[model samples]
Target chain A: MRREGSPFKGLSVVAFKEAADHMASPRMHLVMLLVILTAIGSIYGAIGQIKETVGQDPFLFLRLFTTARDPLPSFMAFLGFLLPLIGIALGFDAVNGEYSRRTMSRILSQPIYRDALLAGKFLGALMVIAICLVTLWLMISGMGILLLGLPPSGEEVLRSFAFLLTSLVYSGVWLAASMLFSTLFRAPATSALAALTLWLVLTLFWGMLAPLAAGAFVPIDPFDPSTAVHQAEIAHALARLSPSTLFGEVTLALLNPATRALGIIFYSQLQGAVMGAPLPFGQSAILIWPQLASLIAGMLVVYTIAYLSFQRQEIRA
Target chain B: MSTPVIEARGLSKRYGPAIAVDALDLTVMKGEVFGLLGPNGAGKTTTILLLLGLTEPTEGSVKVLGRDPLREPLVVKSRVGYLPDAVGFYDHMSAWENLAYTARLAGLEQQDATRRIAAALERVRLPHVAQKRVSTFSRGMRQRLGIADLLVKGCELAILDEPTSGLDPQSTQELLELIGTLAREGMTIVLSSHLLSMVQSVCSRVALFHQGKVGLVGKVSELAGKVLGGSYVIELEAEGCDVPAVARTVEGVSQASRLSNGAVRVDARSDVRGALAAAIVAAGGELKRLSMDRSSLDEVYVRYFEQVDHAA
Candidate 1:
């Protein structure tokens, strides 16, 4: 059966208005400043290291994202750490703030349904994140050319673009998470703290805890190397539960084409594979397709939870 | 009479264990200003929410403009405008921007929205501050802008929840006048407030909500007559004799009492001014001053609430 008007009737107007608000908000400015400063610092340090050690390398541009100074991590690593914070900042007040301000009822009283409002907010935050990531990518690439006096190859540019898209999706996962918390909590501060706490645990401690859990689940015989491999495989699977791990693996595969696999491999599996030979762009993309799909799926799943909750919520607020 | 613009049949709402509204039956006619008057937690706001389809009814149904609001909310909401109690707006946005946003949400074209927004602001007497952010606006200004928002939407029925709650006397009068103008322009209005005098001046009919159920519903004058047993009170000042004893003998006089000022106050079923004055003169008292008093809405409101309290 067909419905009369689209559920998303007012989506574009709401999205545009919300996107403008997000861009002009002080919270967004502060987070964007921090991300840019760290990104530039990491890229500058990577340039210095590349000049000293890999001056003649054909894929020198790729090192800008993967290389790290003694004290600082790579540009991609900084992004993997900081992007979720930005996402959380943008979304932690999405629903609750409207209620606290007493605007939710007035907005809902309009001709649109709750679907438009939720979709508009998510899309608006996503658009802002996409814009920030794309701009930062361009700035880093531009600085690479200016400082190194060498332009990136077409393949390097394509890979970096793919990395940027992956970063956008990675941030979307956190955005959806914070939006969910916003719906669950009545206070904006509570929602922000909740999202930030979950992010801290998943990004900083999940890797360490995954191994312990995996070892408990699949105990390895100390004398059997094959059992140790099985334990390692299980630990790897557990670690991938955190979106950060999935994002890190995708970044690694995209930015460093010579890397073949994310998990343990047998000697027979590597016999015919070319060592140190970068895979083609299509192969690299296919290699990380599952990881990309998982990130997108994670975002959709969290957003769907938020959407259903918002629809069920009373309109008194 | 014309068809009722708003109709609720056994409408009820319960939040968890507490019943906010219980089996409300109400009908508001076209172009008439209906008032919902009650104290806090009396379910006036809950009934308005149900009528607007903002909250779902637990056990009954509501229809706005002949369509079930729950079944087709968008269609109903498109034609109905609601100004919630303590109305809120995007503080950072200008009044024009706020109204324009609503206009767009209501599906007006850009040119049409712009034109209507200007007119709406003018109608609310807020055109001078159209470009200023709502954060800088005073409370009265915000209330006027709320009206401007409804006007921009071209609502067929305007439901204002406590539109005059926090305003000063002047602002309250101004808002009531604006509401009167809207009703005169043929828009049906449902105004919910605890201010009985305000409702008396503007609403043609009202429903008194007590403990989540409507205790009384009728025209204000009709209610005064029905509940108080009389609509008019006659007072006579005399100098020589017992005026209260004589006024009590007049036809249609329900009760008579003498005040300290030597005025006999008589509650009568109808106009008994001539009879009251002649009766006082015949009793050997010189009638000095005589006046007629109609029962105010305040008395009717208090009486209904008192009755409900006693029943509970």
Candidate 2:
């Protein structure tokens, strides 16, 4: 049977309310502070390095993200490490927090369906994250122009924009993962812990686990040299299962235009290529198209799981 | 006759192997304070959820404000206001902000929301604390804010779950008066509580819920007559007379017996004090005192449940 009325009738209302709450919250403020301080520290080191090697690079502005000096990682590396933290912090208590505060039933009793609530919360947090990312991007570019004494090339600006977009989608994967846990677990702390544990395992240990899993699937054979290639291929495929791996591959391809391929490339594949020549922006994006698709698909899958569970859950906590 | 504001037929809810609400039927008319009186876990809150379309029922149907709640939830919900048991608000937001959030969700214009929110807070006598964060408010104040949330939406029907559960007697009294005022203003109200005295004071009619089913439904006086066999009780303190014998001589007296406290307790169909006094005087007895007891919901609830338990 068909239900009456649009399930999205009050969607913007819920979204605007949630986004306002997040923007005003001390948690978002503290997280944004950590991000800004890290950006300043990393970009400071990058500018010093870029100044020393100014004449050698075509994409000097892009180097602001990739170049790093001692005691600090690259700006892109910091984002890869911290974007998941931002996403998790925003979503680990989305639904259960309402239950803890004893507001779930009251909110659900409004004229909207549960579909509006779950989707609105996700959209609202994503909007906040997007705003934070755009602000940081503008700051980094503004700092690059002021410090480097030159504007970025059109190609360099295009590649950097792609990098920013990839980072946002990467964060979406983690946000959806935590929202799924929030729907599954009643306690906010438990959901946060679970999301963090998954993040730690994927970010830190998945690199190690991939090879072991691949070795079991396609064991190395001493008699056949081709077996080694097969093992490496299997390992690469296994690593791609982790969203962190997908995000890293996408970031590498987008920010570094010279990157032609993601996985196990043979010497024969680069035999006729011009060494150190940066690919066009479209080519680099095309190279990471599958990785980008995987990141987006992973986010949608996790978010869909959360939505279904939340729809079926009892509103009474 | 008043039109029904809420109607449910054969409504049931199940959580796995356990039944939260069985096949039950109920109807609440417009402009009446209807009480769902029962112990905790008796399906009162579940029924409210079903009526509001917050949860789907496993069987049967419900209509609120002439619309099917399951099929047309927006219509039902927009016209209905619900205050959950131990209702909560965002602790960090001011009372007006909290109500404004719900007003927006209900699709009110900005200016309309502002005006209605002020009027609602004033109606609940909470205007002074409208700008204060909810965390600083007492439980009674929080409950009043829940009511104000309803008023801001201009809902035609209000369903309250245990609104007076955790309050002191003074707060309960104030809340009941507010509910009475709302009813007087032509708002249909359905409130559930295990507190018999509170429900008895505010509800024009009550349904006694037992194990996910309503065993009896009527006015409190009617339930008392049905369960306790009489609606009035008379206590007589007399000297130089047989009190039970004199009371038995009066018409409409159902039962008469002498108490250990030396008072004759008489159960009657109605207030038979005048006839009983005349009979006592004719019997040459000097009456010291005569009084009639009002029928109480507490007695009806206890006696009804006792009978049910014995049968079970």
Candidate 3:
């Protein structure tokens, strides 16, 4: 039977309630604090490095994110590494926590479909992540101007804004993945562990597993010289299967304006091209458009799976 | 006759190969406190889910207030308030905040929601703890807050699943009284519980669930009369002269037997204490005690199930 009424009738109500809960949580506070402290440390380190090579680079403002001193990773690198953790932490118990707390049935009993509840939760956490990323971006930019004694070019500002948007999407991918696990597992602790396990596998071990899987799929032939290139290409394709790899490529293209290509370039393809010359913001955006699309697609795909499972799940705790 | 607030015909739900609710039929009328009495996994909760359209039945149909719950769930859900079995709240939030969240979900406006929330808390007697976090609330307080949540939504029908399962006796009594007040104020209620005595005290009518089927459904008194063969039992303690024979002579007496304590147990169609006392006195039997036994729900449930078990 076709269901009457809009599935999104209570969407905003659920989203606002969930977002307020996220903002008030101690867990969110701790994550935001960690991000802020790291932002400050990384900006401080980048300023020292930029001062040492002052006047040597045209894109001095962009260097604030890419440059790093010893003992502290660059801001861009830290975000690439920590964004997934932040997303996972915020969403690991999104659905199952309601079950464990015995609130799922009551909430479901309201005049709303499961679509509203699951979508609201994902969007609510995604909104918080966006807010946090925007705040961090503003802080870093503000610190860079204060310490570097220069204003960023309009193009630089736009590129960094794109970078912030990419980071938000990247975090969303992990958030959706964690929520999928939360929907699958009943215990909050089990879901947390499952999400963390996936994170560890994708972040720490995916780089190594990519080549092994590729090599198995396309064995390197000793007789053919070009097979090595083919093998490397397959490896690269396999590695990009991980969301972290897609996010890392997007980060590289946005933060490093001179990035012209994400994959291996043949000598003929680089003919007459000036190396190390910065590409326009639009060109850089075009370069990572596919990567950005993949990030968004990955997020939506994971979220849709979570949505389907949650809809079919029994509401009794 | 009162119009039915809920109606189900041949409703059945199956999870894979296992039947959770088997071909069931039930009806609850407006402003009546109806109880679903059963043990765990006897399909009471499953029936509530089906009525609310949280789960689709494998077969059959159900309607709430003349609307098909499966097709028009929002309308049905808006009218029907549910307090789930072992109901839970967002513990970190204050009780008022929790109710306000549900009120918003119910589409109540700001001013209206605030007023309703205050009145609901007052009704449930939790106005003093309105701002206190629910994490500190006792189980009974939380259950009461659950009721307040239903009240704030202004639902016409309130379905409570095991509302008094874990409450202490005092809290149970208080909650039952609150449920009574809701019924008096013209709310149709469907309460599901495994506890017999609690349901007996408040419910106007009940359905006894056994193995995914309702073995019996009717007014408690009527069921007792049908199942136990008599609605009232009298115990007479007397000295001398054929007490059972004397008790049997009274009007409305259905059966009379002698117990080991030198007392006559008389099953009667109604309260026969005065008539039996006079009869015993005239029979020249010295009476020590004459008391009418209250037919409890426990006996009806047990006796009905025992017959089913024996037949099976």
**Highest-scoring model, lDDT:** 2
- Each candidate's fnat, listed in order, reads 0.56, 0.85, 0.82
Tens-digit per-residue lDDT, B196-305, candidate 2: 99999999999999999999999988898898886588888988788898899899998899989998899888889999999998888999999854458887888888
RMSD of each: 2.8, 2.5, 2.1
lDDT of 1 by residue, A40-131 (tens): 89999998898889335668888999999979999888999998998899999999999987888888889888889999999998999999
Model 3 ranges off by over 4 Å: B236-264, B268-272, B279-289
lDDT tens digits, residues B62-137, model 1? Answer: 8899988777778988999999888888988899999988898888999989999999999989999999999999
Per-residue alpha-carbon lDDT of model 2 for A149-227, expressed as tens digits? 8798998888888888889999999999999999999999999999999999999899999999999989989999999
Clashing pairs in 2: none
Residue A297, model 1, lDDT: 99
Candidate 3 lDDT, tens digit per residue, A1-317? 69899999899998888889999999999989998999899989989988887367777899999998999999988888889988998899999999888999898888888899998998889888988898888888889889888889898899899989999999999999999999999888999999999998998899999999889988999999688889899999989999899988988998898898999889899999999999998899889999999999999999999998998888774
- Model 2 / residue A269 / CA error / Å: 1.5
- Summarize candidate 3's per-residue lDDT along B1-312 as a digit string, tens digits: 389988999999999999999999999999999999988999999999999998899999998999998899989899899999888999999999999899888889999999999999999999999999999999999999999999988999999999999899999999999999899999999999999989999999999998889989999988988898876877879986798887777889888999888777888888888888888889898999887544678878888889989999
Which one is best on TM-score?
Answer: 3
Alpha-carbon deviation at B168 in model 1, angstroms: 1.3
Evaluated at residue A112, the lDDT of candidate 3 is 85
Q: What RMSD does model 3 have?
A: 2.1
